[model samples]
Target chain A: METRTQDTASFEVTPWEVRGKVDYRKLAEHFGVKLITESELEQIRKLAGGELHYLLRRGFFFAHRGLDSILQRIEKGQRWALYTGRGPSADLHLGHILPWMFAKWLCDRFGVELFFEMTDDEKFLVRDLPLEEANKYAYDNALTLIAIGFKPEQLHLIIDTEDIKYLYRIAIRVAKCLTLSTVKHTFGFTDSTNVGAVFFPTLQIAVAFLPTELYREETPVLIPAGIDQDPYFRLARDVADRLGYPKPCTIYCKFVPALTGEEKMSSSRPETAIYILDDDKTVKKKIMNALTGGQPTKELQRKLGGNPDVCVVYRYFQAYVDDDSLVSKIYNDCKSGNLICGECKLILYEHIVRLLQELRERREKAKDVLEYYRISTKFR
Target chain B: METRTQDTASFEVTPWEVRGKVDYRKLAEHFGVKLITESELEQIRKLAGGELHYLLRRGFFFAHRGLDSILQRIEKGQRWALYTGRGPSADLHLGHILPWMFAKWLCDRFGVELFFEMTDDEKFLVRDLPLEEANKYAYDNALTLIAIGFKPEQLHLIIDTEDIKYLYRIAIRVAKCLTLSTVKHTFGFTDSTNVGAVFFPTLQIAVAFLPTELYREETPVLIPAGIDQDPYFRLARDVADRLGYPKPCTIYCKFVPALTGEEKMSSSRPETAIYILDDDKTVKKKIMNALTGGQPTKELQRKLGGNPDVCVVYRYFQAYVDDDSLVSKIYNDCKSGNLICGECKLILYEHIVRLLQELRERREKAKDVLEYYRISTKFR
Candidate 1:
């Protein structure tokens, strides 16, 4: 219901609205989810047979429902799958990849299948964007996922509009369990909301459980997505048992912050969002202008040090920096006044530039292999 | 807007709700369409190259928008197409075939195409019926339409869930023009209505104009359906200009009254509705029990003449009796109280029994050639 920034402003998060400071712990309480604990991370690390993912270790994916059950199922040698999605509303930004990045890591770590959905139909229905544009965005976003190096055999990229013949059959089964009252309660739908928007949660829920239908068995599913998307899963989980499928478990992630630190990174705000395809100069410029935890005056900053807790740059470092030692040094230096905003920005800019350059090259290569990721074959 | 039956309780008519005494003229006014005038009927007769259809001549098809324009376009050597649909919520009954029968005549007379849609998705969405049941009903309904003798080459049978890929693209375009406000206003939809119900108008609109899209030209279109369905076309016509398609013309038919002389023939009321698949014994039983306008006393009936206008038996004779001379004889005999309710019921039963038997045989024949009428091929 509400996401207050830990040390700053209070905010609210819905699939359509994200504002102010997002207090993950308080947000978890409001959403009625358990915060992912140290023991859970240790269990996942053990299952993965390696160091914990930087996202989990750094508390990016910090809350969950039924993570314990999913882990227990996995420990018992039952296969578990990953479910995540993107709404093709605009160009992909760094924030868009946060859940997907974690999803890919989970698939590799556990050798399980992944269901990646592009909700072009939802965007076309809810947004004023043309179907043509929404379809193009779906393809572009799929390319971004492919660039992250998901194995072709392990991943199933499902575009809603393209594969609806399969999805709609299952979607109708899900839609039957949902009442107009329930969708209105969950999504804040009103008399003026288009019918497509009202019916969309069913499609989202269908994809979450589609793996079980495909495998002809109940495979434990883990959805790693923004906390804003929790309402859809809540509705999905509510209806899963009635539809004779396993309720999907979820690991809710925190919002990857905007450059301004005023809200989550959004495609609509070009100045605040560092897009995946943003050139080196643009990325650097955005990082340099980003709001950080440093004091206004250089002298004041030198004496009191910066608040790494409120820094957007530190959040990016926490998201992308793999080495724990390097992440700790960055946080300690910022808090001890050993690092300045300009120096820290330059370091983030260099790291992001190298990362994006590799991704851009990989995305180019991904164009040729898109057919392999399409999940239509699995349905047939 | 309400439809109060003359000398009966008032009823309401929306696309979703049909009740009360349906005043065709008032219903026309409420739906913002003009009653089809005598002159328009004459014009249609001349275009049809003989006597007008009994439905049109009798004012059963009594309301329209753009009928004159469609006639003019046909006169100018341009083609026109027919569009009509059924929501597969129940078994097809006599009331369901009135429009399709008229549509078949239109296609034959005009040498044009017909797009017959089966809204199984809407049924699955709106009703508690499962997809399998809805799909089965769609097939059953399709067989009945095929039994009406629509030329395979001239008719394109479309099933919504099966042919969604083609429909959805155009539906999205049609949906873009519609706002939540307009659909709510047109269909009397509430917040509590399912989203599929909200979005279904777009699909209906898509099928209405599908011929133009397939031929890649602006072919004039005509819709013949129960007056209850006029609201969908009104919304579709409102958005047609912006979507660059010609506004569809419609001829709204009155509901064939139920056998009990109450409301319309409804599949939900099995005793009142004579289904196409009903056995001979069931048909005879329903007709014998039907309410007629005969006097309570035989002597009083001979003195004061019966009311043919209020007789359900007389209405059925009006619908089925094709010969003008015979129809006049039946009307005159009923008004003069010379024809007893028993004799009229016998005559009506013979006509329907023959009609149903022929339809059943044709329906059985229709089962094998179903693939021929499917429109999915055209889209590919």
Candidate 2:
């Protein structure tokens, strides 16, 4: 009945839950993934024509399973695709879009297709949300992905329930190779777990192999996702060879620290995360009231410097701010008592408002072209 | 790990397996089902305008759940449909067609639709057959169902993987209400079972509720299936009210005894069962060698009469023979030491050969209209 063994560990991470302050190094080791190395990063930077996405530069997307093989295939000009997804349980947050942003960069740099899945069926199965509500969120999430600037031709949006005719066959193929024991071990499933939830990982695994069936070729897939999702792809990778599919490669990013300073942004606690649809006033308020490591009083903060290492505001700047020197200056200024928490909060507020404004405009246009980005297959 | 508790009960019956000499009375009692009363049979005969299918008249369909309500609905002229299916793991044997034959009668008598599902996905998951093979068999089985005389307009053929788009949403809804514990207890699922196999019951449950969605009304479903399939509908009935669908009614038939005199005819032992497509020569040979309740020699057989109660050939006659007096005459003649085993087998053989010969011609014609019977929905 005890489905997980992470109780003794300082932090727990699963596809459904993240708790406590996580140690990324130990977590990677426990998950059997290697930390991204400097050489690989340099190779990626060269592949991207001497520029790196801030996510990689800031070391946020820090672990991987088959990055070397993916890189090798890319270097040889062999075709591959970027695969990632969302659960559509709630509105997208900055944390939810982190991997998609990296996936977009991978798509642009490598000129490969991207399979973005909205697992509406999974959300419906695992949560109390109705199927219609989950499906509505799936389309809503697709708009946001389009707002993030993925090209219609390059992106294939797979909403699980809507496209299940195409997905079910592949999912069953993968499902036939998967045992309940493996799912229970990986996702911490118990007898009380709904069979739909236990069977859902196969749908996720199927997306990794979708392109192969779609294109009539053995296409390689690279998945950039939150570290919590490693278990699904790990199981996918385990069964890939047996199913005659290329093992999907993965690059995992650390969780985005919540405004309340939790290890991850959670949809359950609305105040801890800033949703993409949050109005300007809400965004400004959330950012200004965010947790920081500054002293309690202004005079005390000027005498004793703030700790950027533990500050949620600094984490946001690292994730959103593309300028390396600017981030460094802010960090140094805060650590040296030269910058106040209020000023840092205001700067982050401005950056987020500007980013969201652009996204809102693009999101409106995304609605008009939503059909173009949807996956089409002969199966239907 | 011991998935069944029927070991001490003389026979075992699950959705996937049937073993030993099944005691129908004990099995019905153990499964918490009721035997069809004489009054109920008379009501059904009246409903069919003073006649009943041979299967019902001869007590082959010996048990039921919710029959009174179904009869009441029929009396009130409320809309209802017949539901039955095949797993399509192999060629359709005579045993496989028993329920469908009963279903066809119900459809004709009531002028109601029939929903025939070929669970191709389940076959692939539970068997070593490839997906294509299962799908091929699904189409093949569909042809036979048509040959059995189900009108294309009245029959909705649901091939699992093909019609999954329509079924998936409903399946997940049912699945969300189903826990692994329920499936395990119902179907003998263990940790080593493929997750696809574990989740398959929901698809079946979805089919029972499908007409409610298709017609936008809470239509009652009457499933004519082998007793082994009772567990699925039992689980379906348990969840139906919660899902706002009518609790599907079931009429359970005792298994068709194999030629070798096993309690159930299994497709795995090809020689023990006559497939729908078996040639006249093969059918004759199988029937000639079939197990019968005859004495060691013809002289002894003539002296002591054949035992019709224990004869496999007589079981087939009881199923296929429509004339009650003729069947009674065969029984009386055999018991009175007038009819020999070979003569009785030849009579049964001639009936089957004529039946199969007409079926083969109809089956060839069924190929031309296979697409007409397939279920279509706006979901695709």
Every candidate's lDDT: 0.82, 0.88
Per lDDT, the best of the predicted structures is 2
List residue ranges in candidate 1 displaced over 4 A. A1-9, A292-310, A331-344, B1-9, B173-182, B295-307, B332-340
Docking quality level of the chain pair in candidate 2: high
**TM-score, first chain, each model:** 0.95, 0.96
DockQ of 1: 0.42
Clashing pairs in 2: none
Which CAPRI level is candidate 1? acceptable
Runs in model 2 lying further than 4 Å from the true structure: A1-9, A296-305, A335-338, A377-380, B1-9, B377-380
C-alpha RMSD over true interface residues, model 2:
0.5
TM-score of each: 0.91, 0.95
Model 2: lDDT equals 0.88
